[model samples]
Target: MSADVAIIGAGYTGLSTARYLAASGVEPVVIEASRIGWGASGRNGGVVSGKFRIGFAEMARRWDLETARRMHDLGIEAIDHVGETIEELGIKGADYRPTGSLRCAHNQVALDALRAEADWLTGTLGDQAISMLGPEEMKAETGSRDFPGGMLNRHGGVIHPLNYVLGMARALAGQGIRIYCETPVTRLGRTADGIELHTDRGVVRARQVVIATNGYSDLTPATDAVRRRLIPFRSAMIATELLDRPMLEHDRSYTETRRMMRWFRKAGGRLVYGGRGAFGKADSAAAFAALEKAMRRQFPQLAGVAVTHRWSGLVGMTMDSLPHLSRLDDRVTFSLGYNGTGVALASMIGRHAARMVLGQKTDAGLLTSEALRPVPFYEIREPAVRLVAGYYQFLDAIGR
Candidate 1:
């Protein structure tokens, strides 16, 4: 099969890329090893916050204030874009809510930091959409007394992830975009005309190829260099049975301020909670048990609740803790390393990547202007991540 462009991986990035490409009058073929949204895109906590893995203050310290502000604005725009797309496409079953989100602090020190961040966002950066929620407000909103305070971004909310991506897939299919599930690209090579992707079912030759595999990327000689820059880590989530009363007073998504954070939200009358998993293990019964224990610790009211579903998915983490979008070559472009936050950012970056592939200027600002550097000792990332997770757990225990 041949096309103008081919996309690998049917997650948010690939599917959104195909959607945007098709809307631009370019029909692209999307190839996926599994069904759409089979990876982190489907198994996540479903919170759509207007923030990246890196905070605004840290980004400013690392880069510059203006650049940091631009990045932060881009995040908010991404969240708005998701809502607009859902409405514009008339995607059914998305369950998208613009009700906002909460970032709760586990302790007083974290609460202070959260307040300072909120001040910087609203006062210094002129982002009036984010506000500070005190302990009483936090308790009222989340029905959890464990948090001292929190930060609320009115632009963010939650969605039904699987439904959203599936809707995108159906929309693209109706637009005449070819979607091949259960098809894995074994080899990627450059041709005189463009690029060639060797898949199990057949070969796809296209003038442009998009590598959107993210954490589930297959490392071959052609992509090994790019893969070395990403560290794939597993995140596990569990959903509890329907509750008689709503857990939170208000319907909103919530996450902690810990180094290894825990995120939760109410969906379909059930509470879905998720966090970082055992570094080396993909999914385990013990991990789910641990997650349940953590969830109960935060909301003791649900101590005896039955878990209805437990699943884990791999997320690509960059060393610098930022997402990267760049063209690997003249014919190959890629976007990955969302650093455990992909739902909003990935959809925005995917469209940006599509624009890049079409030889159009994208307002990626400072993010896509540079190449991703390789992570040191990339082969030993598993062990290193395990050690880091252990250290973060210790810090969280001490309220640091």
Candidate 2:
């Protein structure tokens, strides 16, 4: 069908952009290679927050101070956006709870870093919602005596990510947005009128095109800028069998450590943990075993917990850990590279991309800045990433 805008990839970014575009009287068509949210957007720990390792200060330096704050706030606001949409549309299955998020440090040094980060968010960044937790408090809240200290952000929350995406797609489809599943666009040809997207079923033409395929981005023709700037990394996650009643009562999402950070939470009454998988073997048996062993070591009470589900997905990792929203060409725009933090950022970036495409001005920041240039030597990024992943896997094996 003909449209004003055609979006490839019906994951969070594509869905959000389609909704906004449709609301603005633009009946955008979203084409998904598989089912909606079939990628990382569907499979995630569902932590919706802006507490990224890429702190606000660095963001301000890269983009602008005001823009950085606004971008950070946007990430925080995406959680509310999801909740509001669920309520407005009366979606039943997408469970959203504002339970907040905690970041614990396994060691004393890392605990100090957590305290410092919390302090920076409060003192410098003016985000007072962050509170430092002592060792005793961490033990009480997380039911993990191994944690030395931590920080909690009340603005953060969790949800069933897949259910949310599916609900979003349904909401958009009801609003005249044409969503075609299992229709991957193999060719994107620019014409005088607009862009042509060639899919397996047929071809579509549109004035504007958006590439929302974050990690799985190679399917369509990408501008050199995008190809050079973004690197895809695979993250693995495993969910344990429904924990016994005692463990269930103390379940909450959390993360720890310096390099290989662990992000996990209780979903469907089972403990789900995520982290860097074994590079090329991301989510392979070795990776799953490592995740389970690490989890068991963290909470020996859960040593009896057997893994029931294991999966992995590629994430677009930008050097700055921020995503890009810009015009690669005259009509082609994109918002990619969530840096393993897509739950909230994808929705927020999708909104930014929509605004940019719709010709609305946005606060320029690291998350939405022209200064987000391509990384140096980016052509070799994929190979370098693979090498790094292999090295990390080897080190992880030796307990380094």
Candidate 3:
């Protein structure tokens, strides 16, 4: 098989790349090791967070205030693009909610920090996208006194995750872009014409390759460079049969300012609560048990509620907690490292990648500029995530 471009992984990134490339009259084929949306794209909490873990103040200190403001604009651009896609395609059953995002602070110290960050965002950057809600307002919005305050993004919201990716695949199919599931690229070789992707079925020779594998990127000889940097940690979720509390009518997604990154939201008649899983990839009963305990601790009324379902998915965490794009060689360009906020970001990164393939100008800015350094001692760190995860939990406990 031969094509102009080949994309690995059928998640949101790969599908979006194919979508954009096809729209530009470029021939692109998508090949996935598993079915489409079999990874994080299908299994995540479905929040279009449009957020970065790093606050704007810290970002300004690291780089410059101008760069920090640009990052904010980039996030909104990503989610807006996703919103436009859903509307243009009229994706059925996506259950998209434009009700916005509420980032609750677990403790007073965190609340103080959030308030300061909100001040900088509004004052220094002159940004009006987010606002700080005090304890009283947070209590009314979240129906919980555990939160001291919250940072509200009035644009970010939630969706039916699986349906969004599947909808994109359907639209791509309509455009004659081929998606082949269970078609893993075992090895890649640079040929005279382009890169050759070898699979059990056949060799696919393409002028260019896009590695959109993200968390699912494996430690194989073909893609070990990525695995060393991609911290493939698992995050799990439990859905309650009944949302016993009064969920905020305005907020569609609720995430807490914790190192563990716990989140929950109203989904129809139920509530889907999720957080970091055990450090290992293979989930344990202890992970779900911990989730239940944490959920009850946050809302004691949920102790009697029945957990209807439980599941886990991998998130591609980077050292800097930012998405990255770079070239593997002259023929292979790749993007990854979303740090668990990939829902909207991944698709936007893919569009930038497609534009790169087309040799067109793209506004990726720092996204395409910051090529991530490979994680140090990744071979050792991969097997021993407990030490790392434990430290994060400890930081949360201390409110650092």
On TM-score, the stronger of 2 and 3 is 3
Ranking according to TM-score, highest score first? 1, 3, 2
Candidates in order have lDDT scores of: 0.85, 0.77, 0.84
Candidate 3 residue runs with Cα over 4 Å from true position: none
- Which tens-of-lDDT digit does each residue in 1-400 have in candidate 3? 8889999999999998888888788899999988999989999888996677677678789988877878888888888988888988777888888788888999888888888877888889887877988889987887778998898878778989999999989988887899999888899998788899888899998999998899889834566767777788888999988765666656479989897789888787787889988666588899999998888788776767898899998989888777888777788888888888889988767778898887777767567767777888877865667787788899999888
Worst 10 residues of 3 by lDDT: 219-228
Better of 2 and 3 by lDDT: 3
Question: Among these predicted structures, which one has the highest TM-score?
Answer: 1
Better of 1 and 2 by TM-score: 1
TM-score of 1: 0.96
User: What TM-score fits each model?
Assistant: 0.96, 0.92, 0.96
Model 1, 28-130: lDDT tens digits are 9999888889878877778887687778987888889988888988888889888887887788999888889888999999989988899888887898888
Q: How many steric clashes between backbone atoms does each model show?
A: 0, 0, 0
List runs of model 1 lying over 4 Å from the truth.
Answer: 219-222
Cα error of candidate 2 at position 21, Å: 0.6
